[model samples]
Structure formats: structure tokens, C-alpha cells
Target chain A: MFVSGLGYIIGETFKGLYRNRWMCITSTGVVVVTLLMLGLFMLVNLNIDHITETVKEQVEIVVYIEDQAAQEAVNDLYKQLSEHRQVEEVTYVSSEEHMRRLQMQLGGMLEGYDSALDNPLLASYEIKTVVPESVVELAEEFETYPAVSTVFYGQGYVENLFAVTGVLQYVGMALMLGLAVTAIFLISHTIKLTVMMRRKEIVIMKYVGASNWFIRWPFLMEGLLMGLVGAVVPLVILYYLYQYSIEWVAGNNLYFLSLLPAEPVIRELAKYLIPLGTGLGIIGSTFSIGRFLRV
Target chain B: MVEADNVSMKYNRCKQYALEDVSFSISRGEFVFIVGSSGAGKSTLLKLIIREIKPTAGLMKVFGKDISRLPRRRLPSLRRSIGMVFQDFRLIDDRTVSENVAFALMVTGASRRDIRKKVPHVLGLVGLQEKAKERVCDLSGGEQQRVGLARALVNRPSIIMADEPTGNLDPGTALDIMNLLRSINLSGTTVLVATHNREIVDRFKKRVIYLDQGKLIGDEQKGIYTHVR
Candidate 1:
């Protein structure tokens, strides 16, 4: 009997959909488009994070040591820099190696300046910080070192990256929220139309003393079915777009855009989509039919 | 059994009384007819009995319980004790005849075993066993009325309030339905039928309550449809 009831409900839902074909189709289309736009923005945000992380990983703080600094003083500075919690790795570059690399880089400009052995470049300790905020603190701390002449970092550029990504995250969230609300509203109205067409049946059911739950189940199921169906196209679109993005980044040698692993994102999305679609469907149907079923 | 003591129902903030100071008692296994013309408060009295609408004054009781004070939540159980057959034969169009009859049992949480056993028996009682599987839409007006009767009797309520059960049927079909109701009342179910069918009233000669413009004009045992302005 339960199976028969379920089958009857499913059959009736399809019949209702067929009767309001234009409304159903239009609502589904709206859901798909909104989800697609939201998904695209998410992908873009993920890639941006990947690129920012790669950039942060490459940025290193170089602390130049004074020319007259003693060997022990330089060792003390290195220890202090390493003891700091923010430092990931510390590498020492002697003044001679620094001058050799400078000479190699400026080979054409410094061709005849060989006798000018005043290689003002100092023995530097390159420090990699774990987080962006630590870079400024580490730079300031290095300036207090007796062996360190000056401490400089690309703080301006890093701050700009942080600010831009923060704005993007907010914008992405607002856009997704707006689109979700609109999609739910449209789907609810569509289900309302379906309910209106069967108002006579509902009225009879109520008069016959059928409980509110019994009357609500079939319509809720109908909405859930529509939501599930509506989600399919957008999920497929999102999957292909993710795959294309991974491939494009990999092909372009954009190693920076690899923060979100493709497999995990896809897996997480699959887990989220089923429940999200079902919930949206149920909510839309319930909201639309709640007032009408009050009797 | 049903009892009403000075029951009055007013609507729209006491501007009009649908039923005013009406009082009557119906016993089990008795057949009574509430005879009234259009707008004579027949439906309001029925609704009050079923506890679908509450009375504005006085006390009403059904099955030895105060119906006027019954909570909205308890109305379902109260209604279950009284079978109501509407004039329009409110059978769901999409359901088969057997399903329509089973619905009454279904709402009261009757066991599936009971439904399977009893639905066919009630349909058989109403002489519609052959048309059990046919959709209600396929049945004629008279057949559909029979289906409604079958549904009402399936639960074996002590009282049946039929508001014009045969209003849409021809005289022949209507008589058949009346005979069916008489048989039901004979079998220990009190039947209260509200109709304006003077021919049925005069022919059957059952107890009748005559009403005019929401007022009870007369009550008689085995009465004829006699009323003067």
C-alpha cells in the first residue's frame, strides 16, 4: 500500500509537471543558470586562492648583514631568525656568492668594472615565513639585529593581494546568496501554480479530514523531484568546468593555480548537491502550500 | 444518539442566527428526517452535529459527549462516530469505488487487515460489489450516490447525518437510496437525513423536523410535509 501511494504520488507529480510544462521548464532553467553562475564564481575563487598561495610561497625575506659584522654576530642573527616561529627555512648566502650572482645578472652592464672589487653586496640570510602577516613582523625584528644593515620586504604587494582576495570572497558570497534566494522564490511560485491547479482535490482532502501531513507529502515530493532534476544540469556543467579548469591550469604551467585538488572538490560537491537540491525542493513546496493547507 | 438543548448558532459577530434555540433528541436505531427548504439552516444544523461549526449558545451532545465544547483537535474522533453523506457525493474522482469506501476506514487508522476484509463487505451491502474496481467518475449519479452510502456505512457509526443524499438522483434512484437508508436504520444505525424532498417524506412517513428560515416550525412522528405560512 505504501508503495502504491508512493507510485501514485510520483505519477501525479509527473502529470502535474506535464500540465504546467512551461512553468516547470522555465523554473528549472532559472535554477540551472543561477547555480552555474555561482559554481563558476566558486571555481574562480578557488583558483585565485591557489595562485595567491603560490605567490606567497615564492616570496622570501632577504636580510643583508653589515660588512664589518663579526662571524659570531652573524651566527647570532641567524639563530634569532630561525628561533622565530614564523621562519620556515633559513639559508645563508656569503658576500662572494651574492656578488657573483649580481655580476652574472649585470654581465653586460658591469663588463669593464672587474677591478672595482668594492662589492657592496652583504652576506644575506634568506628567510621564508609561514604566513603573510609574519613577514612584516620578521622584517621589523631583523632590523633590530646588530649584523643587519636594513630589512626590506614586498609588504605593499602582499597586502594588496590579501585585500583583493578578501573583497572577491565577499562579492562571491553575496552573489551566491542572492542567486539562491531568487532560485528558491521562482521554484516556489512554480510549485504554487501546480498546487493551484489541484486546489479542488486539496479542498476535498481537507474536508474529508485527511491530516495536514498526508496532504503535504505528495506536493513536497513533487518539489523535491523538480529540485533534484533541476540540479542535474548544473552539476554536470560544474563538473566539466572544474575538469576544464584543472586541465587548462596544468597545460599552461600555472602550478600556482593548484590549491584545490580537483578530485576532492568534485567529491565534496557530489556530497553537497544531493542534499542541497532535495532541501531546496522541499522548502519551496512547503512555503508555497503552507497557507493554502491551513484548513 | 444525538441531543441538542436550546442550541443557537450566530454568524458574522451575532448579526444573524443560522440556528436559534433549536432543541431535539434522536435515539439509536431511529430514522429521522430534517425537512427544510433552501436557506432553512439544514446544513448549519448538520455542521453543528458533526462539530464542524460550534454553537453560539446552549449545549449540544452526540454519542453522550458534549459536542459544542469538543476541541478542534477532538473533532476528528467525533466525526468518525457519525457518517456524513453530502449532497454532491464527495467521492474522490481519481479513486476506485473500493478505495473510496476504504478511505473512511483509512482515516480512523483501521488495520489493513480490517480494511481489506470490510471494504468489500460494505460495497456488497450497498450492492456495488461488481463495480468495486471502477473509478468513481465512471459511475452514474445514482451509482455514485450508492458509493457515498457505502463509504458512510463502512465505519458502522451509530449515527449517519446525510445532507440530501439523493438530491441529485431521480425519483426512482432516490427511492432506492431511501430504502437503503431505511434498511441501515433497521439494522441499528440511527439515520438523520436532511432533504426538501416532500414526496420521499410523505411516502416514507418517518419522523420529520420541519424548518423555515432557520426556525424549527414543527416536529412529528411519521409526519407528512405539512406547513402553512
Candidate 2:
């Protein structure tokens, strides 16, 4: 009984979809456009969150040592910084390693400086704080050390990045939520119109002793189909577009910024967007058919 | 098979009553006609029996159970036991005759094998076996009503209530439909028809329940369209 009934319901759902093909297409289009906007915002927000976290993790105070500082003073300073409660780690970069890094970055500049005597770079202690926000106080303390020649931690830029990313997250979420609500409303109205055209059939079904569930199953399934199509279309389009974006960023060598990887981001987006779209479709049809069920 | 005791129904927010102090009992296998002019409550009484509307006052029972007190969940079971035909021959016009008939069985969770078997048999009973594949919209008014009858009978309900089933057909066609109903009744399925067609009502000479101004004016066994008292 259950198998036959399920077959009947599925058959009816397909029949209804064909009967109102234009309406289904229109509703599916609405779902696609809405989810696209929401998905784009979600991707952008995720990437933004990734970029900010990367920058925050790189936040550290670099204290350059004086050229004449005693070896004991430098060792004492490194041990003290590592023991500090606010510091997570302290790595000492010798002047020779510093000149080698400059050679790698600048490439060909000071190429003849093969000996330590020609290396003008000072040895430094890099301090990683437990909290990125505590870098200001830690940098000030490091600058007061007698062996320290200079202290730097990208103070203004780091603060501004954190503040900007926080606001962007909230704004993106609000916009996505608004788009979702609008999509549900528009899709429901479209399904409502389709159901209204079939009101007589529903009444006839009721008169023939069909339970409410028997009549409702078809419409619900149709809604789910429309939603699934809507969701998958945008996901496919976004997947390719996101992959291209990551490649474009890499190809252009925009080294100051990095995007979240395409595969994982798109996969996570699909996980949420598909269910949301299908759930919206069901809700739309359920509410649309509610008024006609009175018969 | 059916009973109504002092039933009264008034539409919501309306002062006029649709059915007032109407009482009648239809036994199993009985062929009964409810004859009355428009707004005389013939259709309203049929609607009441089908449990479409609860009476504003008094008790109504079908198969010895008070339908007025039946829970909403059980209404479908009550409706399935009684088949109903409409004046408009209400059917899905785009579908074939067989599909329309099969729909009645499908709703009650009948198996596909059962539908495949019963649909052909019911179509044969209505003499539409050859036209089973034809769409309902393409059939004549008489043929459409036959399709309606086929749909109503496929469920094998104990009672059949038809509301002006032949209102759209000519006199000759109406008489043919009436004869079909009579034969169905003779086969031991209780039939209740609501019609104002005096010719068909008189020719049957079966039980007639007369109504006037929402009241039961007369009920006579072996009666005609017009009752002399």
C-alpha cells in the first residue's frame, strides 16, 4: 500500500509540475537569483573572515637589538620575553638570518655582502602575544628594554582590519537573511497561484474521500523539486565562479590578500544553501495550499 | 442506512435557514428522491448527509452514528462510505475516463492492481468501456454524467447521493441517467437523488420526500413529483 501510494504521489507531483511548467520555472528562477545573492555574500564573508584571521595570527612585536648590545643582555631579553604571561612565543632572528631574508625578498640588492661584517641588519626577537589585541602594550614594554633599538607591530593597520571585518560580517548576514525572506515570500506566492488554479481539483478530491495528506503530498513534492533545482543551479554557478576567483587572485599575484580555498568553501556553502532553498520551497507550497484545504 | 432527526442548518451570519426542522430516514437499498424547487433545501439536505455541513440544530446520523459529533479525522471515512455525484459532473476534464474513475480508488489507498482491475469493471458497468481512454472534456453531457456515475460507483459505497446529476442534460438523457440510478438501486446500493425534474420523479414511482420553504412538506412511499396532501 505504501509503495503504490508513494508512486501515485510522485506521479501526481510530476503531473502538477508539467501542468504548471511556466509557473514552476518562474519560481525556480526566483530561488536561483535569491540564493545566488545569499551565497555570494556568504562566500565573500567567509573569505573576509579567513583573511582577517591570517593577518591576526601574524601579528607580533619585532624588537631590533643594538649592534653593541652584550651577548648576555640579548639572551636575558629573549628569556624574559618568553616567560612573559602575555607572550605566546619568542623567536630570535640573528643578524645573518635577517640579511639572508632581505636578500631573498629584495633579490640582488647587497648581493656582494657574503660576510657577517658587511651585514647591517640588527638581530631581533619576534614576540607573539597570546592575544593579538595585546600587541600595543607588549610593543611598548619591549621598546623600554635597554637592549632594544626599535619596536614595530603594524599597530594602526591591525586595529582597523579587525574593526572592518567585524562590521562586514554583521552586514553580510543581515543582507543574506533579507534575501532569504524575500525568496520565501516570492516563491510562496508563485506556488499559491499555481495551487489556486487547481482549487477545483482539490475540492473534487475532497469530495471523493481523499484525506488531506493524499491531496497535499503532490504539492509538497513539487515544491521540494523546485527548491532542489533552484539550489543546485546556483551552487554549480557559484562553484565555478569561486574557483575562477581563487585562480584569478593567484594568477594576478595579489600577494597582499588571499582568498579561502574554493573546494571547501563551496562545499560548505552547498551544505547550507540547498537545505535552505528546499525548505523555503516546502514552506511556500504548504502555506499556498492551506486556504484551499477548507473544502 | 441514513437518518436525519429534526435537522436544521443556517449559514453563518445569515438570518435565513437553509434547512429547517427536516426529518427523514432512508433504509438500506432504498431508492429515494428529494424533489423541490430551488432553495427548498433539497441540495442542503444532501450536503448534510454527506457531512459537508453540520446542522445548526438537532441530531443527524448515518449508519447509526451521529455525524455531527464525529471528529474531523474520521470525516474521510464517513465520506468514503457514501458516494456523491454533482450537477456539474465535477471531474478532471483533462484526464481520461479511466483515470478519473481510478482516482476515486487511489485516494482511499487502493493498490494499483486493484485499480487496474476495478476501473475496467466499473467502466463496463456504465457502458463506457470503449470510451475509457477518451478525455472527459470531449464527451457529451450524457457521457460525462455516466463518467461521473462510474467514478461514484467505483468506490462501492453503500449509499449514493447525487445532487441534480442530470441538470445539464436533455430530458431524454436525464431519463436514461435516472434509469441507470434505478438499476443501481435495484442492485442493492442505496441511492438518494435530489432533482426538480417532475417527469423523471413521477415516472420512477418510488419513495419521494417533498420539501417546501426549508420544511418537509410530505414523504410518501410509491409517491410522485406532486403530492395531493
iRMSD per model? 4.2, 1.8
Runs in model 1 deviating more than 4 A are: A1-60, A85-120, A127-145, A183-237, A248-259, A270-272, A280-295, B10-15, B35-40, B68-75, B109-113, B166-179, B196-204, B210-218, B223-229
Q: Which TM-score value belongs to model 2?
A: 0.85
Give the least accurate 10-residue stretch of model 1 chain B, judged by summed lDDT: B71-80
Best by lDDT: 2
Q: What is the TM-score of chain B in candidate 2?
A: 0.98
lDDT of 1 by residue, A1-295 (tens): 5323556467657766675677677766766675566556666666665676676677778898888999899889989888888889999998788877887887778676653467767789988888865777778878987889877677688667667766776786677678666766665666666667667666555555555665677778777877787777777888877888778988999774565777676666656555666677788778777766654
Report the Cα lDDT for residue B163, model 2: 96
What value of lDDT does candidate 1 attain over all alpha carbons?
Answer: 0.78
Off by over 4 Å in 2: A1-23, A55-58, A64-89, A94-123, A129-134, A137-151, A255-257, A286-294, B37-39, B197-199, B202-206, B211-213, B222-229
In candidate 2 chain A, what residue range of length 10 has the lowest lDDT sum? A1-10
